[model samples]
Target chain A: MSLKNTEAVVLSQLRLGEADRIITFLSPQLGKFKGVVKGGRSLRCKMLASTMPLTQVAVWFVEKRTSGLHLISQCDIINPFRTLKENLHKLVSGLYLTELVEVATWEVEPDEGLFELLLWGLGSLAAGERLQAVLRIFEIRLAVLLGYEPQLSFCLGCEKELAGRESYYFSFAKGGVICAKCRAGARGCKISLGSVNFLRQALRFQQEKLGRLTLTAASSKELQQILPAYLSYHLERKINSLRFLNLLNVRC
Target chain B: MLYTESLAKLVAELKRMPGIGNKSAERLALYILGLPKDEAGKLAQAILQLKERIFYCSRCGNITEVDPCTICQSPARDAGILCVVEWPNDLLAIEKTRGFRGHYHVLMGAISPKTNIGPEALRIKELQARVSSQQVREIILATSPTLEGEATAMYLYEVLKPLGRITHGGRIGVCR
Candidate 1:
């Protein structure tokens, strides 16, 4: 196997036997992959910050031609995102982003948009942007890229445009907005029409200037419930890190 | 697939064990078959006996054959100072050193958001009860220095702060 290199965002690391660790990372060039970082868990390990989840690192590894764990030789930190870990809420939200990325995509398949989004999301969090807004954008954009994007432009049931400032039902099962007439006994939460419009605009917002668009407390609360529940419905389970994020009282 | 019914059953059973993959389970099953019949019987009996004997201590959540566990019932232990640890293995490590005379409260695990484990799933409630009921004045948080461990310590401090002194006791990492 030849030495391969990629700029990756750390997703998670599980401790292996004693000093070894199995690091899951997402790369712009290589998608998601697990690499064995020898001595990564040791007290003397210098590569600790590089392997920390949510950090960006330039990694060199011996890629196995067969489908097995890669041997990571060197991983240098690109952006540690250390500030994100200082606060409990930010740490869980940052982890939520990586967990979303890890589960949304398959292994060894590159998606440049998702990779860039991951970097931008972590940077926003580390730079002290509001947690709820960053998380909402990250979740929606992730679903869009992964082909589970929730329907917000129009009502899925009535086949009419979702209009005005009234509240509408956003169904996780139906994957879109439901008009009041068609929303009777729907299996989803009632989201404000304003929140739906905001979600749509936020999705189209340029990644570089995401933090500029401030969300109101009400809109943030609505999107926080709608987007995650929808994503969890598609993924067939709750996002584990999100519950912890909620408990730390940093949620929308 | 195995050649015999019993071998197949053995492989299936061994595969259920932690860290035993299908291949490893098969290897272990074959190894067991190669052993003398009495030795194989002894191994099976040992596993059964282990399950019947070992249980979680009700007081601290540590794995023990006794209900309160030896440390909880020990007259030598200083009950006024409690050391809250993340896991039973952590309690064992602390005991191996024989440096601490205080009682322990095993959390079973830390508050790891990535793993969906919050304060609710841990033994923090029992720790709170111990503090309110017992003379737990000086509480030492002996969790790991990992982010999840530190987060757990912080949460514990919040819950126990009103009750007693709270401090962390893990080896210093590269980060403060």
Candidate 2:
């Protein structure tokens, strides 16, 4: 067994027994791993709040070789993103971010960039940034970070530059754009050129400069139409949080 | 090591239980095998009766042998004050304290978007109906301090705010 200490964001947690929980985390160094926390479910346990989903913490855990489930020894809360928990929309969005991270990545494959993207996304939401822009930026950037970057520059069908198209069909299977001429009977979501340009900018922006780029309401609507469906298609599973997020969006 | 088919089947069934591993399941199976015939029969009968008889209290969502549950039907408990909890166990925990005399509403689960659970999945609608129909004066959000718990509480607070005065019991556990 090896004791490892790393900073992580809680992705999700499940109850283990009477007073224990299995916490899934995404760490900059450790990637994704599940660790059992003794007394984690106890109401009075000091680690109760620290071990919650979406909270960031520095955790020390023992990596058990036999079971492949680590035993978490200590966790110190970094930023609980307490604000996100207060608002349902923000909370759902934050959970969606974590769920994306949880489902998109594999275990123990550390990617510092992906970890930073998650932290940045959560921080932006908690800081009360524009919800739609934050979400759209996060979705595009995350897709790029995970190497599923959408083909925004050119038409997949005719290999033509897609700079001045009125609109294009985003092909989920091809992970790129299909021009109007090439989209005959092809299954894809219709996206406006403005939305396409915004996504390209989102992909090209520096991580630190992401906040400076705000999405227009029109582009926001268009990207929202395609990004999640694209990601879900590539990920090959229904994103559990999307339905809840959609419900909230419709209500508001 | 190989066990007889019957013993192996029993062990496998027992191992399916939460917190029960191979060793504990085997030990429990052997212990059950060693029990007196009538004692073993009684144990099996009890399990059967539990499944057959016990059900959720329709009014408060607590597990009970009756429809409305004793607490909901109790004359001593104050119906005007409702304590909202994430699960039935939280209600039991509060009952063990015996300090509060209010009725309880068990949500059955909390809102965790990661798990695809939302406010709609919970008993928030029933809670609203109860508040609207009854003369409820105060709602104590006795959810846990965890993210899902807090989220559930906040969502309930938003839904139940215009109806009555809401008391936020941010921490509902044994701790202060």
Candidate 3:
């Protein structure tokens, strides 16, 4: 078998026997790969650092003749996300991002655009600026990428353009906005236009420019209500990591 | 035009794994066919050995070849301190840190009303017995930091505190 070299982010790892590990990674070129790293549990193995959750690395592996478990030969760290690890809130958010990517993306299906989006989100989180906003943007963009892009331009069902005065409902089942008229038969949470516009801008902005978008407490609270429902509707399950963030908020 | 009996059986076996579907299972079965004979044999042997040899430790509920497990038998470990975790896997996590020199009590799961898992469903009775009989000073609740985890910790604190001096462990302690 030939050795393939690529850049990847460690999504998760599981112990496989005495000293080896079965690692799940998201590679830019190769999509998701479940590979076996020999002696990964050993202290002398440099791959240990690269195998950490959310660490980006360049990996060299051999596609073995018989099993889907590629044998990792070497790994060089690209970004360790050291700052995210040090800070509790950021670490939880980073883990949430990783969990989302691992769940949403399919194995051996390359989506370069989504990979770039995830990398940018991780980098933004590591940089330690406007984390809440960064996370909101990431969630919106991810939804868009997955083909469930919210219809912010108008009422999702009514085909009428949204105006600043009216409050709209964000529906997970319907996959977008519902105007007051459209809300009669729809099931969702009511959100102000200000918050809707903020979400709209977040979806449109480049990942790096996400920090510039200001979120007031009102908008943030509205987002908290709307986004979770949006995610549960699309992903069909509540994210576990979100609870930790809510707990942290309560503590603070 | 159709798969043989052995190939179909292999696909069915592969599909049993979490998150693997029929298509992926078929892909995996095909991939296994491509491996060198010895390497594939080793993989198959490992699975068989795991199923045959690995059993839950009677005392702590951690996965081990022995009944009481190596940790329970280790003279180096402190019998007075017991770290409570949600799963056998969590026991491995605590052991990996080398920071805790105490014995462990794996609950097998946390109490989740949504999942219909209750205190009686877990190893709580056994844990209480261990605390009383083994002279455990502290019972660290190292469950996941979820709403259910917090509820479980509180329940354990209420139940164990009246019996003895069980410290009220917080989310920060167990998760970090």
Candidate 4:
């Protein structure tokens, strides 16, 4: 069987046999992959460096002509995400992002948008962007890519265009904005337009340009309150890793 | 026209995934067919490799190719301390912290009467044997903060109390 070469991000790794490892990766070209790195568990093996969580690497693997686990022939590290590994808070946030991506995207499906978003998110986290803001943006963008993009332009119920209103409620259940007129009996938290605009920009902005947009302390906090409910509302359950990110005392 | 045997099989497999539904599965199946051959081949290979290469560690029950896993083999780690977890993923969560300096024991699953998974269904007996045979001082029960996890921890506590000290390990402790 011929070996296939590709670039990938190590999403997760598990030991396979005595010396082998089952490496799960998110690749730019191939999407999500789980391959076996022979002798990865041994100290002398160089594959260990490439088969780590969030490590970007160029990899070569052989797929048997028929069908079986691909054998990871070699891997060269691209970026080890040193800052992410060094800081506890950063590491958890990074893991949270990985988990989010794993859950949001389909296995083996080449989602260039989702893959790029993940790479950008990891870079942003490594570059020390505000953790909360990064996560909020990540969630908003993920929702957009997955086709749950919020109707930030208008009241989802009435289709009335929303301006800088005093207060508004985000309907996680309805999957969009609810103007005050429709929020009386809505099943979501009330947020200010400042927070709503921030949410809107998070969805609309390019990753590199995300740095230019800023959130006030209040808007940031309001976003903290809204995004999770918005995600859980659409996803139908709270992401388990999100709790770890929230519980840690890292200021965004 | 689309409700053929192949489409049905694709839907069945897609639906087996954690959160995908029938509609989503159908969409995914169609998407898969639309992909370029190489892309589709890579996807298929990834799934096949995960099942082919990934297996639970015989010693700790964590997913690893090796017998004792990297964490278990590290001489720098404190062998005297063994952190018991409900699943391999929990072991990964603990490992990501790089805080714990010890070994691990994966139970493979928790004791849930509701799920009909009893103590014998888990690696509890192996865990007990490991504690007794090894120079172990503490067993940190790092299970999920759930009903099943709590029950499993309690059961372990009862079984291990006589063997060693039943100390509260902290948030990173033995009991949940």
TM-score of each: 0.80, 0.89, 0.63, 0.59
* TM-score ranking, high to low: 2, 1, 3, 4
| lDDT, candidate 3, A1-252, per-residue tens | 999899998877776866788988898788888899899877677777788767898989998767888999988899987886655567667777877887778888988878888888888899966877778888888888888888888888778898877778888887788988878877888888888888889877776677789887887878876786687678877676676566545544
Question: On residues B83-110, what C-alpha lDDT tens digit does candidate 4 reach at each position?
Answer: 9998888888898998989899999887
DockQ of 1: 0.38
Q: Count residue pairs with overlapping backbones in model 4.
A: 12
TM-score of 2: 0.89
Off by over 4 Å in 1: A15-19, A39-49, A148-162, A173-175, A182-188, A250-252, B1-54, B65-67, B164-176
What is the DockQ ranking, best to worst? 2, 1, 3, 4
For residues B1-176, could you state the per-residue lDDT of candidate 1 as single tens digits?
44589988888888887678889998998999899999999998999989999999998888999888999899998887778888889999999999999888899889888888888999888888877887666777788877788778767766766664334542211011
Between 1 and 2, whose lDDT is larger? 2
State fnat for each of the candidate structures: 0.60, 0.83, 0.00, 0.00
In candidate 3 the C-alpha lDDT for residue A14 amounts to 72
Candidate 2 chain A weakest ten by summed lDDT:
A159-168
lDDT, candidate 1, A1-252, per-residue tens: 999999999999898875799999999989999999899887678787788887889999998878669999999998888788776677778888888888778898999999999998888888875878888888888888978778888888878887785568888888888877888887888889777767887788788777777778998878877888888889887679888777666523
Model 3, B1-176: lDDT tens per residue? 37989899999989988768889999999999899999999999999999999999999999999878999999999887789989988888878898999999999887653334557789999988887788776667787654356556755765576665423344322211
Worst 10 residues of 4 chain A by lDDT: A243-252
